[model samples]
Target: MIERFIELGQGYGDLYEMLEIMKTNQERIHNTFVFVSEKDGKKVASFAVAMKPVGDSKFMPIYICREGIPYNAEKTSQRYDLFKEGIEAANKILITLEVKHSSAYVETTLYYQYLIGLLRLYHYIPNLG
Candidate 1:
């Protein structure tokens, strides 16, 4: 299976589009994720919607709004709140994980590969066939 992260810009106005994709394709929805990371000493989050592999292609696309919203236990950004509300409205529990910032890798592709491995290890997504 080819599982990939399709970045939809940072978590700004693009967040709404991500939510809309989930709402419209609820059936194909496999899991919802909120990846938290520390960048420049500030905690931020990336919201993602994982969709099941479609047909024989075995292309599983994980739509994401990369790290952009401030996230912490003390307080939350309005953007994060909207994402949380959408998850609740969809009756899906958010899977939160603390991870290294994408900038840690030389390439964005490497960063995504690291995320895919982590997801597979946790059984959030299937392993290689």
Candidate 2:
């Protein structure tokens, strides 16, 4: 399967769009993930949803809010709460992982590749054929 990460910014206005994507495609939901990583000494998280491939298509789109949420700071914890509640409502298992920051890689593409590798290694996603 061809899987890709589609970024939705730091989960502000874009967060709503991501939620709508998940809510509307409830049946196609595959997994929800919370990737926690330290950015400039601050703990931040990136939220994502992996959707199953439709029909004969092999593209599995992973929608995400890339690392910039707060428990109580510039952004409120309510945003994260909304995400948690949404996942709970869908009854899908939520997978949380501690990972290195994207800055570790020379390019964002490399970072995504590392994540996909981790996902496959953990059996969260199908192994490469």
Clashing residue pairs for model 2:
none
lDDT of 2 by residue, 26-91 (tens): 999999998888876888888999999999898888888988785333464877878878888888
lDDT of 1 by residue, 1-129 (tens): 899899998846699999898888878888999999998899889999899877778899999999877788678888888888888878888999999999999999999999999999999998899
Q: Highest lDDT: which candidate?
A: 1
Please give the CA lDDT of all the candidate structures: 0.89, 0.85
For each candidate, give its TM-score against the true structure. Answer: 0.94, 0.92
Q: Write down the lDDT that model 1 would get.
A: 0.89
Q: Which portions of model 1 show Cα errors greater than 4 Å? A: none
